[model samples]
Target: MADQHRPGTLGHYVPYLLGRHLRAGAWPPEIGKRAILVLLGLLAVVYGLGFGHMLGNHDLSATLRANFLLGLYGTVFTSTLLVDFVPSYRPVQRLLPDHFPVSGRRSAELAFLLDLISLRRLLLGVFLAALACVPGQQRVALLGVALLLGATALSFGLRWLLTWGRGRRHPLVAAYAAVLALAGAWLTLAATKSLTGPLAAGLPWLVALLPLGLLAGQVAGLGPQFLNRNLVRPALDTAESQWLARLSPEWKAYLRKTWPALSMGLAFKVFLLVASSVMQAKHGSDSSRSIFYLVFLPVISFTYANNNLYGYLYSLTLNELQRLGLTSRLLVLYLRLAVPVLLLDCLLSAVLLVALFPASTWPLLGLLPLSAGVFLALGLWGSLSKAKPVYKNLDLMNMRNNASTLMNILTLATAATLYFMPWWWVRAGLAVSIMLTAVVPVRRLLSNHGPQRRQLHHRLQSM
Candidate 1:
């Protein structure tokens, strides 16, 4: 009887031991490292600087303070995601201690709770709290504490729900993230306006208390056995299998050329197509219906430019492309990759056109070249300016640079005006602007003999 009871007692202690092992290191050394910490610190300093303006200029307005805290919470909330979603590629059994409990749900909960109380995460919360305290805003620090704990409990429950039972459903995870983003956006917008209802008043309180229910469930042995090799293996395997099975090879290869590899932009593009359809349905004959396209068309550049233009250059090493003779041949190669993406856009646009008006959509296709020229030229100019071209450097000017961003805004406004002005000559102005923008940089890249070109080639080889 004493020996039988000894097994149960030892099993209970396994969780505490696992927690101790995880807390010892698993993180700063393994995950964040020195460089990442430095980057994170710099970002925090930038946020602190921004907050300094709020304190100085606005005298800590409630709306501004709330916005600042919510943004800070978003940054800290990333840690919960990193811990739960990022799988350890190492063999599962090796991560655990020897002689751990067989029925390990309780131990798993303990280990996960300990993992959430990570030193790095706590230090970040403390750092942000310190920054918030500089302006004598104690509420910010209190909000940070609540956010960290709430996010941890939420993530823990989600991770368990995803990993438990028969198989992993990866779409549910993406859907969850999208819903959360939309909800946050709605709340942020709503917070700026007046609140009058009991629901509005109680929402924050309800959210603050929500994590308690999840935490209680976790302690009751409802969480997944994260340390269990059998469970971890199947769940991860199923997720990978489902992902590959869902996407075709052609579509997958196309995405490889794009940023935000999930094709989130494509999703947005499809959304615009639906909007176009609705506009066509409502006021198909009205001249003002063209406003729908005018407003949303420029945004396509955001999705298209990175994939077909800026990113295309790096897809092949410079040395490899040089062998193909970089002038006309490279231009052809660029078109080959770019045309399919444009064609997809055209197909979607054509569908909207057909649904709205059963006439030729041929004129609308002209907008494709205009978009291609604008974004591609920008990409080429950005690449030419940098000695060692990085993706972000070639993408756009720093968004924080008000002057460059303002110039882009003006350009978009001017182009959209030219597009919708109804006169052929006015529309021709857009084409002229695009041609002037695109031709020179493209010619320079294709010319292929200069110190700059040689330097770029050398850099590519070294990389």
Candidate 2:
């Protein structure tokens, strides 16, 4: 009776509430629908271009095809998790029923269905299914369907337990997923005897189906209270969590100033490190490991760039740092913070390299920090040249994205060439020339602090 009497009960109110949320702003449903359509259209174009590239190169290895399919499946599954459960950086948080006066059970069910059966997911499924109809990949299509169902269900249950119910569990859940993925990859490698083989073919299905079983296990334990508890809400704010209390004062300050950007970068960095190490372990031979390192030179270089510059800019953390005065001190602060992490990465990578390469080739490990430094210098150069802070506007943002991508490609091409170059002196000359070229930009960026410093000094004095 109370449910029926309630003015905004889930059944009667949710649709209206959703309508209000959608129509609240200038953006109309047609615009939203058109945006979604355009996005799907772009996905189609991307798939076509990717397929054409593969065909053009005549490089359609089964491993490449399998990995591409798996990536698509993972993308669809990740989009679901991101839309519904993962509370980090959600753009649509304002539109959720949590903001309204809806009752719990109905809201939970509706949210669950909406998250599970989203239009984006459906479109992606249709796209992938059509791709599977390609000459030799019907099984891949079936596997994709199976993965979508299984990963979505599994993420659903995981979100209920790790994200929906309690304190700061989502981060732990992410860590758990990373570890689980690595373990699974290790198991697959062990079973297959090679990274690419028949085992890889069946692994995707198994990976997808395993989650369904995991989801089933949680339901009995969760009981009826699950419905009452499952309504999607904002992730618990860990801004003031004590987890970082034990960090050194400098580290704490760095994290406080950087906030989510630094945290995200660190997570990504860790994942890259793990992935690189795993690949190194798989390729036991010295030549293979050397080649792997050379091939991924740009990747490792860009990992640092992505974590630092990209993350800071995207999260608007760089703007925050600009308030501290863009003087030599600020530059030093960044380098000091970077050095510890860079050293750690270098050490881990060196350990992997040592296991695979001769001691003489060990000097090449210096390239990690060297290239990272070069990119950081380039980032500073770009920032200073604008006379404003980094990542300021749409046009600049587009320029930055394109420039960063082009830089990465050029860096990769150069690294690959250097790897094949026989003359040691030539490699040394190139390295020296690159470093020397970087020095001018780094120096210019450090000195170009005009009015910003005076304002920043006053702000600091006031603080």
Candidate 3:
């Protein structure tokens, strides 16, 4: 085959090539359409702000500039290391057969270049560009851009080192401890103005470039050496199946049917929780003000579960749903089950808040109503929409959506309510909202349109 990395005579047909590749398999068309909609929505927001004079504020401009720079640097740095971190791409190393017609070096290069053309890179670029449009101090913006670029390169390089080092018998625990200590010292210096002088001002910028340099060095030296290394496969265990078998019949059935989806959901939740905990531990003002972590942790974890479960439910082929003769009952079951699951999530969140922020326990409890209400609203929306889940192994699109205005509004509203209202009253209001949102929607869905039911039946009949 011709080199995949090299431009062909149809260089101008890059878009066509991409389209063909994307459409070749069982591609979820909805995901692409939704992604385009989101991009357009963000652009509209930026243009609207410009017209409304919202971006005219000096402070806003300064913030935007800083964020833009930071975003750009972060994007590039993250993108460079993406191939190493993303598991799906891990197999690329083994994909190139040793006896292939092409030279080994050329094959590796092609694989690396193809990895660079990933959807992750494209989305990162779009997001970074959007961040750049945010108004901010020009210098801060410039600095952010520079820092983002530098950090990205550095991250890529460091990731390569980490991968290489993982093969050795080094004490990773000690390395982690050292890193934590260094981070603590850096934060202390920054907070105490110990590093505020001329020396300190230039250090961060310089440090950012180190990653890029390291990545370059790795690419030059270690790239070929690592390319042909034997891929290691971890041993698999079926212990979970034994445990699942011991559960109640209903629970066992659920596990049997949805284990893969559930496992993926649980893994994603654990990752987020751990990441949030680490961030809070590092940056939180004492352990007392860890309310943000408490608020976010359970909510996100449960949201991921709900979304994933819905995805698993949808993954059942239309024929399968029909074969079971349970489509109506299942939909009803979904609506019924959503409440307790969401309530459980709310209760868990409240407990975390109480544990972390006893002083603000009353206020935190008050926020529960709001959280529950939002969850119920979203659940109903998802159910009624009955949109097929676009189950990308990596949910890049959903991640982007979570960072958007709709999510921002929810966060802001929750924050504002917590700030202004008395704890007891806010709690009361939250309770009322949850009941209204959840109950009202369920009633509406049951009463008004039986169209979804009819369609389900029609589809089954056709099959």
Candidate 4:
């Protein structure tokens, strides 16, 4: 009875002859959506209270203000990127507006609403802004937040204004990009320079106000053509088919957007390496142990990128399609790709760590084969035991993922075992034992994989 009253996802579509404009607003599906947001907001407040001391460590007014503004800008900037880019990457999302016939202005409005809701990073910004509130900062943390928001608004308005012009958007895009690049470069240099120079300067706050006039202007909304990527062309749609011949049918099939994950997997390792380096000064080599132990994933990074490489997502092809396929061929196919890439990641990460801490990292070299093997085997099992649909491009928000909490826990256990064991030999032995756990799953997959094939294919058409 309650559901009947709600209008959801274009309950009313006007025909060309009847109504003048189409109604495109989408409401939250259920009351729980708003309830969850309320709970999250409350949780963020509690979290902020807990992290207050770390933020406010430096009591100087200038230091605190600079740090707060920096955190806010970083949060909004990064979160904005995710909101703007993630939706466009989703295969379904790209085609939705195209088919749905939502006007560009309506699409932009919806995007803005989603962007506002997805700005959960504002919570973290507030938490870090506590840095400026410890009684010594020259500028108020609250005021700094306001300034950043204003700058953000002004930038957006200007971006829309510049791009809304006729003809070539390329030149306009280039000019916009150049301005942002210059601004970013200057800010980066200033932050890295002596603290008293830019960190304590009042100039940054004043500079944030540069867009005040633009903020007052009424900017017209642009269409999704301005926001999203050009449509994914069919294989033979263009002359680019020259390169298509070079790739095998299988590669052409799933080349299934795996490189993005692989590239991201490497990026994940790089980030961990940087984090470990920062923590190494304080916690020693213990911090970087993740680089060695968690070979399945360097971070939670690739979990969404698809835990199972290759046909794991497209098991529909190997299993149900093409007169039913063998699991071994699929298994071999998956491992064939996953093996070298992950091991290389592990090796490169180890080598870099070794260069940093030669004596401590030598164990990483010894543990490399065992640790990498164990996770690779586990990844094989993980990829098969549960199935998820394939997508053209990976997005930050995707429902069709095979990753589970248990897998992450098991990966972490590898770190814990290596961490507690003083003897490097014992650690390698444990990894070998861990590798054995994949045997049962491998046997099951070899014998009876029909259910998994079905699972992978389930609702795949919707994606």
Q: Which lDDT tens digits does candidate 2 get at residues 408-442?
A: 55556556645656776776666566657756645
Candidate 4 per-residue C-alpha lDDT over 10-124 given as tens digits, one digit per residue, 9 for 90 to 100? 2243232112221111123457555654565567666555444445566647555555556555454444434333333311122134445455444444433333333333444
Pairs of residues at least 3 apart in sequence or in different chains that clash in candidate 1: none
Off by over 4 Å in 2: 1-103, 114-127, 135-139, 164-243, 246-326, 356-363, 369-373, 386-422, 438-463
Native-structure RMSD, model 2 = 8.1
TM-score of each: 0.51, 0.58, 0.54, 0.66
Candidate 3, position 167, lDDT: 31
Model 1 C-alpha lDDT per residue in residues 1-463, reported as the tens digit of each score: 5564453234445567656665563334545355555566567666665664565565667767655655565556555444444322111222344364334554555545565655446566646655665666565556556656666665655555454543245444454455356436535555455544775545544454466454565546443444454344344367767886797543444343443322434555565556565555666635345555643354443333432242335445364446743455545545565566555655665555556544554466566556555545443443333323234322211212211233345445655665567776756676577558767656765786465466556644443
CA-lDDT, candidates in order: 0.50, 0.50, 0.45, 0.50
What is the Å distance of residue 249 in model 1 from its true position?
7.0
> In model 2, which range of ten residues has the least summed lDDT?
389-398
Clashing pairs in 2: none
Local lDDT at 15 for model 3: 54
lDDT, residue 176, model 1: 47
Model 3: how far is 24 from its true place, Å? Answer: 13
Best-matching candidate per TM-score: 4
* Candidate 3 error regions (>4 Å): 1-192, 198-202, 225-309, 315-320, 323-344, 355-361, 367-381, 384-387, 398-463
| Candidate 2 vs. true structure, TM-score | 0.58
